[model samples]
Target: MDYLDNVARNFTKKYPCYLIPNQSEDKIKAFLTDRVKT
Candidate 1:
């Protein structure tokens, strides 16, 4: 589970404004589902 934990930590560190565990899963899913511009 270390890899998952690191990804979570890195995502939080990179996105300080986005809510983490407390955020609605839908929001997170939306972001990931959206295609990246680059």
Candidate 2:
């Protein structure tokens, strides 16, 4: 449960767009990675 909760929190914080699907992990990863590049 803790692991799941942490992932949930991280996902939401990193991708606050509620309209996006949670299954889009790759998209989120790319978004965050791009953010780090700047």
* Model 1 spans with C-alpha error above 4 angstroms: 19-38
Alpha-carbon RMSD, candidate 2: 5.6
Top candidate when judged by lDDT against the true structure: 2
What lDDT does candidate 1 reach at residue 9? 57
TM-score of each: 0.44, 0.45
Clashing residue pairs, candidate 2? Answer: none
How well is each residue in 1-38 modelled by candidate 2, as lDDT tens digits?
45444565588777578327755655655665666579
Count of backbone clashes for each model? 0, 0
The sequence of per-residue lDDT tens digits that candidate 1 reaches over residues 1-38 is 45444555566667777654575344544454453323
Against the unseen true structure, what C-alpha lDDT does each candidate score?
Answer: 0.54, 0.62
Candidate 2: worst-modelled 10 consecutive residues by lDDT: 1-10
TM-score of model 2 relative to the true fold? 0.45
